[model samples]
Structure formats: structure tokens, C-alpha cells
Target: MDEAIIVDAEFVAPVGTTAGEFVPIDRAPAAGLLLLVAFVVLYAKVISKLGKPAIQEFLWEIITRIVPSKQLRRRKEAQLRAIEVHTQRSNTSSQDQFAKWAKLDREYGKLKVEIEDINNSLTASKARFFTIISSAIFLSTTGMKMFLRIKHRKAAIFWLPKNAFPYPIEYILSFSSAPLGSVSVSAWLMICDAAMDLIVTIFVALVVGVIGMLRSNKVKPKTA
Candidate 1:
């Protein structure tokens, strides 16, 4: 019987490994991780404002406290009746069901306003919640780029937060310098990587984009 020879060679897997593994942490990686932790803490704070689960829980807490069970039951029954009627009547024109739609839209609006009020209260308790968060996330993203671009130096100009720009701006800087730095096969390779990234990002963004736009309507006043 012929036995296959086992070869020891490093190869990038065609399909990447998805598993738990340890990479030795150095100062730079550790510092980057620490910064990531800080950003995440702040990001959670921001999402607490934007996130629906938090808001739903918040509303439910307040709702259970104030609204009587009888009232909540009646409201639920009413909503169910409207839904059942619409379901049973297959021939009902969607436009002709303006009243039902109006009711739904109104109820949805009330839910939205309640969520907004909680968010507003949260915003007030923590003023500049969105601005500060957006700024921090954007700055951290840009700072990562600047750290890569500017040589490791102790100079304040390089180290200062003032040097950081908006998130999109960093891409512009990196993209522009690309022409100057990418003069060989290396540049071409980088472009391929960038194109792959852009394609994935755009695809993801399109999915998010639809949801994001719907949120405006979801969060807005009910107008049939």
C-alpha cells in the first residue's frame, strides 16, 4: 500500500477558518484593543439611545407601571379585530381600507412617539448623546488611519485628537495617496483588496440603507 506523504507548508486557506484562536498580543495590538474596548463602551451608550430593544424594554417598563391591564387588554383586542377583518376580507382594496390603515398608522405613530419620548428623555439626561457618540466613533475610525499613515512619533501634531478628521475623510486621504504609493504590483494587489471591500460594504450598506430609510417613516408621524 502506498501512503500519501504529509507536507508541512503554510498556505492561506481558500475558505477562511472560523474558530477561536490566539494571536500573541504586542503593545500596538494591545493598545488598539484597549481603544476598541473604549469605543465599544461608548458605542453601546450610543446604541442604547438608537437600539429598539432598549427602547422597547424602556417603554414596557413604563407601560406596565401606568397602563391598567384592562386598558391594555382592550387595546390589544381592538388591534386584533382590525387585523382579523382585514385578513378575512380578501377583496377589500388596500386604498379603501384607509380607515384601518389610518388607525394602524396612528397606533404605530403613538408607539413611535413613546419611543421618541424615552429617547428624548435619555438624550436630555445625557445631553449631546448622538453628537458625542458620532464624533467619538468617527474620530476613533479616523485616528486608526492617521496612526497608520503618520510614522510612529511622539509629536503632539501626530498624537493630538485635533488632527483627526471625519470618518469619510480618512478614506479620501488613503485613497488619494494610493496613486502615489501604489506604483507596482503591490498597488494593483491593494486595489483588488479595496475593490473586494467596497463591494462587500456596498452590498451590506444597501441592505442597511433600505432599513434605514424605512426607519424615518417608522419613526415619523402617522400620515395615511
Candidate 2:
């Protein structure tokens, strides 16, 4: 009877391995990983720092640009005038006229209230959306950092304070312990590199096109 040999069974069933195996770390890859960690921290910081202001400004700009303020004022003034007219009529008119004006006054009041409520609700929704998105980004980064710390035993380089910590102390301690150089250096380099590449590519493309256009014009014979 021939025995079947299992090849790389340990690899296939790594969980079954009793003792841990040592894997060599390469500096290049390690540096790259650190760089990635730095990028995540910096990107999150940049977004969180700028995102709120940018979104707020953009929302206000949209409201200002698309909503006709003049029209809104005109409508409000007209509604006010209608209420005033009905009030004056109700004061001196017959019972039937008074009843009709009273109904109109109530309806206009409700309508104005509803309009204000709707505007308030819309404003609240915009703020909620901004909060939710920003929170999601922040929580996601914090979760990732937490996971890395637990699984890889990596030190916390950059991370949000844990919810378990007390407020002001948490803020002070977490920030004080942050590895700012590790977090920011690689991130800035990556950002600068990307920006420079984009600029150079655009400049080169424009120059090439202009040169081609000039050459074509020079070579073309003038029409009589």
C-alpha cells in the first residue's frame, strides 16, 4: 500500500500550527507600510480639518445662488399684506364676511408656519448629513488604527482617542502621544509628489499641443 504525502499542509492549515513561524521583514516594504499609515492619518486630518468649513460654505453658496431671495421676500410681503387686509375687513364687515376672513387668516397662519418649519427641517437635514459623513470617516479611521494596534502589535502612530477615555484628558493624552513625524512626513511627501506629477503632466501635454499647432501653421501654405 502506497501512502499519500500531503504537501504544504502546514501552510494550508496555518491555524493548526502549534508554534508561530518567523517571517523576515524587508525595510523597503516596511517603509512602504509606514508610508501608507502616514497617508491615512494625514488624509483623514486634512479632510476633517477642511471638510466642515468647505461643506458649510458650499451649502450656503448653493442656497444663495439658486434661491431667489427677492422672490422669497416678495412672497412673504404679499402674505403679510393679505393677512392685514383680511384682518381689517373682518373688523368692520358682516358676520359672513368676518367668518370668511377668519378662515383665511387661520389658513395663512398655518401656511406661514409650515413654510418656516420646512425651511428649518431642510437646514437640520443638511447639518445632519454633514455630521454623519464626517463621523463615518472619523470612526472608520479610528477603527482601522485600533485594529492595527491589536492585531499587529503596532504602536498607535496616529489615532482618535478611545471612547472609554475621559474627555479633556483623553484629548490631551492621545494628541500628546501621537507620532507626528511618522504620521505627517510621508503623507506630505506623497501629496507633494502627486501634485507635482499632475502639474508636470498637464504642462507637458499643453506644451506639446501648442508646439504641434505652431508647426502645422508654419508648414501650411498661405491661401491667395
Model 1 C-alpha lDDT per residue in residues 24-76, reported as the tens digit of each score: 21112234433443443344334433454544455555755686654445555
Angstrom error of the Cα, residue 14, model 1: value is: 43
Could you give candidate 2's per-residue lDDT for residues 11-56 as a string of tens digits? 2323433334433222122455456555655555554444556756
**Top lDDT model:** 2
TM-scores of all candidate predictions against the true structure: 0.24, 0.37
Q: 184 in model 2: Cα distance from truth in Å? A: 14
Worst lDDT window (10 residues) for model 2? 178-187
